[model samples]
Target chain A: MIRSIRSQAQFYYGGLVVALVSLILVGFNYYERFGRLKTLDERLDEQLTIARPLMFRGPEERPPPRREERGEDLRRPEKRKPPPPDRFDPLPKLRKEIEVARFREGPQGEEVLASLIRDGFYVLGFKPNGEELFRSENAPDAVVPWVNKRDRAKKRDRDSFQRWSGDFREAIQFGQGRGYLLVGTDASRLHEGLNELMLKLSLVCFALTGVVLAIGWILMGKALRPIDQITKVAQSICEGDSNRRIDTDSIRNELGPLGRILNTTFDRLVRSVQQQIRITADASHELRTPVSVILADCDLALRKESSSERKQETIELCRDTALHMKSLIESLTQMARWDSSSDVLKKEKCDLGQIAEQTAKMFTPLAEEKNVEIIIETTPCETFCDPLAIKQTLANLISNAIHYNKPSGKVTIRTKRIGKSNIIEVEDTGFGISSQDLPKIFERFYRIDKAREIEEGHSGLGLSISKAIVEAHGGSIEAYSQKGIGSRFVIQLP
Target chain B: MKILIVEDNQRLRRSMLEYARAEGCVADAASDGEEGLYKALNWDYDLILLDVMMPKIDGWEMLRRIRERKTTPVIMVTARAQIDDRVRGLDEGADDYLVKPFEMRELMARIRANTRRVENNPQPCLEAGDIMVNTVKRLAYFKDQAVELTAREYNLLEMFMYKRNEVLSREFIYDHLFDERDETVSNMLEVYVYKLRSKFGKDSIQTRRGLGYVFMPES
Candidate 1:
């Protein structure tokens, strides 16, 4: 959801910027075209002003007299039909007998008239066709013919029009000429059409920018597609589907870091869950056996005529089982406490060898019942470990050994100082382990094929619990065995 | 001695009754707290075998009531072997606490030990016909002459004195007399009864044929 929102915002703002720039470009083009047209109109006006003398002959020929003067009835041009395409030529419209400046302003009238006619300006000379140029009755009435003597030299001042006209005529003889009366043409219309074209081009450019922005937004969304999938997978994982994995193989980027972190966390959680299941199942199974035995024994004793001896036997059985249950509960509670506070073991030091001896003596009868010799060979040794935990570990290992040993077998327990370490070994002549079962022997409830062992229902927790205790004591335990031979367990304490 | 067992579990109650009868006590049983309390409050018994768990009134309450009325010795019989439970049961007016599924022999021993304290009522002469037993010296006086008896015989005589009128079964005789290894299948109780009768006269100890032997004391 977040990814889509970000992508949409990118699209909207990106499109807006492109359209704005295009609009500005269009406005700029319109401005440039408008400026060009205005300059062209001004040049046309100046040319008309230069040729005024040829047409009206004096400054009194100003149109409308600036204020309250009779206006010249300059007739509008007749609407001429557009030429056919086949006969059309690339030339501007013009009128015949348009005014042109002559010796009144310059002496080189012939050259000036030739240049004017060639350049699309009709330069009708005054002497040749002046009357024809002014034949219209509506032309400004003050247009008088130029004087050739003192009447022409009305003012001697340099800034006066008489002196200026004399200078203009001299300059014209030296190849400088004035203007012409430009007639009816479509130049203004052409300027307006060019402006329209510029405006349209600018609009197209704006439209192109819009299309580019749209495509950019879509491409960006496409490029970030994998990110969206990754985000969805992340959300699912956070929602407790720890097994949900990001499967995008595009692992060359930041997503790889996220995927790896999630996978690592899930793996740890899975392992802990598996351990928890095994622990609960093992505990329940262990509890069920004793409870079933007590219940069955009580049931039997209850239903029949149990003699004093038989009644006593059943009661004793119940007592023993109840004690076993109590001990098991106590051990579990202790283990739980230890699990929560393992650092408490660091507070004390005790002798593990003596504890091992005491543990071995506890099962002396069980060993003797099988004609087995339990030999406790040890050097005096002490270590900084939980005495209770060490005793429990030793008892568990020795019990397992006794339970699995053969008749007339020798069970040897040896503790020694091996180069600054306390080493304990419990070896028994028993039906040993197969190589295949070695790896998982210390796993909870992992009994080695119970049918093959002589003991009935040997709880597989002995080794597992021993391993836990040893590890908690900063120690390591290992087992070595071969089928048909004896098994040996060795523990090293630091 | 008439004993009352107040156990909730039918099986445990029956077994315990059987155990008490084997120890030569005239045992009566109630299956719940209310029945136990009713029996315990009204009846005169040497010992009350109370189980902890029961309907209505439990062993602790029954024991408390029994102590309040008669001060009769009450022994708690329970499967809850927790030390704290035992301590609590004892603290609640039980004379002793025995964890159940106990050995029949151990139960008999505990019952005897608990009843001994209540039997301190001064009886200068404990007599049965020509046999006049001295309670203080633990002596058997017979035919105007003292007859020396072993510790086992003395205990047997004491049991007979407690239930002088009621017949004691042979199964009841052997349990209190012998240990676990004694072959109870033999006619051991008959042998002991014959010996006692011969020494003290057969008329004093009446044989009920198939039922058992009864000590008929002279009124």
Candidate 2:
């Protein structure tokens, strides 16, 4: 539920740590419990195979007492040592007890002996000659026979072990070359030891999981701390400190590249927005000049001593000024529409040569007035393009060619196809732009000759608009000029 | 007042020139900064009105060039009305700042105020001896009684009052009385001076022996 990267990562790590530790603890508890129980069953089977034979033998007189330090053995002169603890060699004690009960004498003695040795276990044994040697009262009646049958079936005579679970939780193992053994341990002791082990393991696992979660939380926080710094900087920018930027240098992880990219994007956005603001200011400044001209003319006419001729001239001047402003606004509107991003272009099949010819004819009168010749050379170039947009773009180029050209200079409009591309070129033998002004000719409101262009009612957005139109049709426009020779504008269309 | 307008925009330059001339102030116009600086440094105009944004050389560059030669008063005219621009203009030795698309009357008033600095007085009327000229109304008063004179005579008399004890060259008087557009005969300046002397009395206008004339009347 936590959305923060640091918190989410810590949460997942904590859960994994807990699950992994718990699984390891449970597995170790089961393994230890199984091994302990198996070892206990094997030891008990060995003792049962050795002690039962001694129990059935009743007594042995030849074996000397292990505690005798002197040579004399007086049987009745010393107090009898109580039988030793039965684990190391229970056969001696079992033989004494069975002999006292006279277990071999009758069924009563056998019952007494069996009751004495019951001890929550069953035992059965048999000799190699297929005769039962001993069987407790609760011993399974078919234990020895079943073991013999299994041994024959397996085609081997060796010790074997088997265990069964549930209400009859015990182990049954069969014997060596002399006899067979069937022992059923209570199994409650193994279960009790396993339960205790699980409790202790759970306690340790809980503590370990806690430590892991804490360490994960700290590590995740360290990794994600740069995100906090970036957020703070972005917030500051939103609050109008627009120049604030993220410090990408201090970020030394995966977020480093992300921070650097974000900083670059922010820098670009800020620069573009500033440029837009500057353009608006320049546009307003441009509009002010024509308005000032109209106002000045009106002021001149309002003078009482002015003659009628002066007033009439001012009236004409005002009309012309108003017309110039209208054209300026129109140019501005065209550029604004282009900048707004939807009224881009409508494409269709059109001939580049025919359109160039038509555009040249359209500019014939202006060219004649300036005494600039218009020459068209084409190679029947046909391409998919927006005809009207391309015409307008060509007109802009031709107009600039004529306007900036020297008198009697030549303007050549040439179109040709070059390897899957259409090239439209407008070259003029005019006063070419200087090297410094060549790159910025297409920028909005940038003019090499500012005074003359403004006076001639050129809003300076012509080339910019032309660029937008040409580029909208998936083409590019470039300019090359040598100051004294001429300038060339080339448009490549695909 | 003779003011030079150095503005790159032709329409705005023409309007300001016409308005200044109509207001009875001799005015000259330049379409770009290069021409503006040339005229400004060459001529002895009372005040220079400079537009900040120009093609060849901007208003600031022009102002700096002019200051290197003389201490002519400059009023920077610009469409940039930002405070930083105004401060920069003043700090760069401009006498005043005027924003573009301005009222012609305000421009004229500011120009008049700056022209008074040329006379070393802060009032509208300039006085020397018993003669006084009201620069605003282009009117003259001799001993508190108004005198009738042509516009050229009044201009010549006002020039003399501003340059009181200094001798004026014939060419300087002619240049100040008429703008670049005016075509004058060689004797036009003498005629105006002669008429001014006849009205104000002979001793009031002293001719400095083939050099020029001076308005050093007996104190």
Candidate 3:
């Protein structure tokens, strides 16, 4: 639910760390406690078993010791003694009972049994006459409610086991009609050790979770520092310093594919903004002259002393200026459309060769008047493009070639397919663009020969429009020129 | 007064030159800043109308080059209408800044204001002795009577009135009064002096032998 990745990761991962640590700690505590207690219980069982045979002073001289079979053992005092041998072993085994007992071998077994009794382990026995036969020093004779496990052997009493209802895990058993013996070990220290371990582990889990979250926060901050820097750069760009950029070099784990993406995006945005500013200023400047012309024409026409011929020329000039404005507006609109989207391409399968031929035919008269030879060498250049747009671009290039050509210059329009692309080239033996002006010719409203160009009423949008249209078709246009030698324009359509 | 128009756009230049001529001023135009700077350096134009953007050299460089030698009133006409651009133009020694798509009337008014400032006469009306001239309407009055005058005669008279006490040389008058396209006559000053002498008095413009002519009209 956290909005931030760092916070969310810290919350969930910290919870997982806590849960895993607690589970491992509890499992380990219980495992060690169970192992130690099992060893203690088995030792107690063995000792009690070993000492059981020493309990009966007289094996069977007396009648069966059934007096204390029910609940009479608790009335006797505690006992610790070796039991008699199994004189009644051949007696019906169904009347016999067995319980756990253990003592180690050699003289060390006696010391172990003594230590076991000292460590809250006990052995007690009852006499046949219902008195306290023998008791370990630490044995007690408190009344007890036993939980018994009945033996499942063929001799029903052979493996009889019983323990107290309390946590001491004590047990007692007896042979047939004889007083039962007791053997039990105190295991409270195991529970105490486990509880202490749980406490320490809980503290460790809490501290570890906190440390993990803090480290996660620090590392996450390091990972996300670029966002702050990028945001700062974006803000400054909005504040009019478009040249400022996000420093992508020192950044990692950026929002996009990399920091380079955001930097490139900002670069593109700044470029577009600058282009837009230039276009606006240039368009206004371009429109100003025509407007001035129209206004002056109107002023001249309105003068009362103006001759009829002068008025006639004024009207013509105004009309021409109006037409120029119209064309300028059309070019501006076309550029705007392309800027928004090249969706206006409306591409269709066509041949660039045929388009060039048709465009050359349209310009044949002008070329002839200028004494320029028009040559069209075309192959079947199959391509997908908007035919009208392609023809217009060709017309523009051809017209420029003718307009700037020498008196006897030759203009050639060639269209052919090269590789997987369709190529259309217009080469001319004309006054080519200077090197400095070549790169700027495709910019809107840029003219090389200002005086001659202005008089011709060329809006300087021809090459710009041609480029726009060509690029809209997913094509590229390039110009190569030498100052006085020639100029060539190439269009590559994919 | 003679004026120079330096504009990249041919239509605007020609049209404005015609309008200036119509307003009774001899005007010439250049197509770019390179040509404009050449003409500006060689000629003593009363005013220079400059376009900011040009093919060879831009207006700022022209202004900078011009400011090093001449102080001819320059009015920068450009489409860059930003306040910073205007301030920069003025800071670069331009006399005025006019944004394009401006009304012809506004442009003419600004031209007149700048030219008058150069002439040390901010007001449109100039009165010397008994002769009063309204430079805006190109009208002159003598002793409470309107004196009908041709554009050239009026221009000559206005020049003399503006520089009333100073003796202007023949070359100075000729160069300042005529545009390059004007058909100059060697005796044109004599003809004009004779014409003005009959209207005003002989004492109005007294010849100083080898020096020049100075107007000394009395009230």
- TM-scores for candidates 1 onward, in order: 0.39, 0.64, 0.67
What lDDT score goes with residue A126 in model 3? 62
lDDT of 3 by residue, A13-72 (tens): 787887888788878887887787777667767766655554532234333434355345
Give the winner by lDDT: 3
Query: TM-score winner among the candidates?
Result: 3
> What CA RMSD would candidate 2 show?
14.2
> What is the overall TM-score of model 1 with all chains considered together?
0.39
Candidates in order have lDDT scores of: 0.63, 0.78, 0.79
**Candidate 1, superposed: residue stretches over 4 Å from native:** A1-6, A30-34, A37-211, A214-219, A228-244, A294-441, A446-459, A468-476, A481-487, A491-494, B1-219
Per-model DockQ: 0.02, 0.39, 0.38
Which candidate, 2 or 3, would have the higher lDDT against the true structure? 3
DockQ: the better of candidates 2 and 3? 2
The candidate scoring highest on DockQ is: 2
Please tell me how candidate 2 rates in CAPRI terms.
Answer: acceptable
Residue-wise C-alpha lDDT for candidate 1, range A1-494, written one tens digit per residue: 43575567765777678767877876777787667656544543443445445443454533322111324343655454444543353231122123223333455444434443343333222332223332222222333334335533552221112112221111110001121132211244545677688768767876777687678778666666667777887788668776787665766566577767866766666656665665565566556545644654565566456567776888987786677667666655555444443575653677777878888898898888877889999777877887877887888888778777788888889998888899999999988888988888987557665322212434555566678778877789999998778899999999
Interface RMSD over true interface Cα atoms for each candidate: 11.2, 1.6, 2.2
Candidate 2 per-residue C-alpha lDDT over A114-194 given as tens digits, one digit per residue, 9 for 90 to 100:
643565666555555557766666754444345445445553433355555343333443432444545555567777778
- Pitting candidate 1 against candidate 2, the one with the higher lDDT is 2
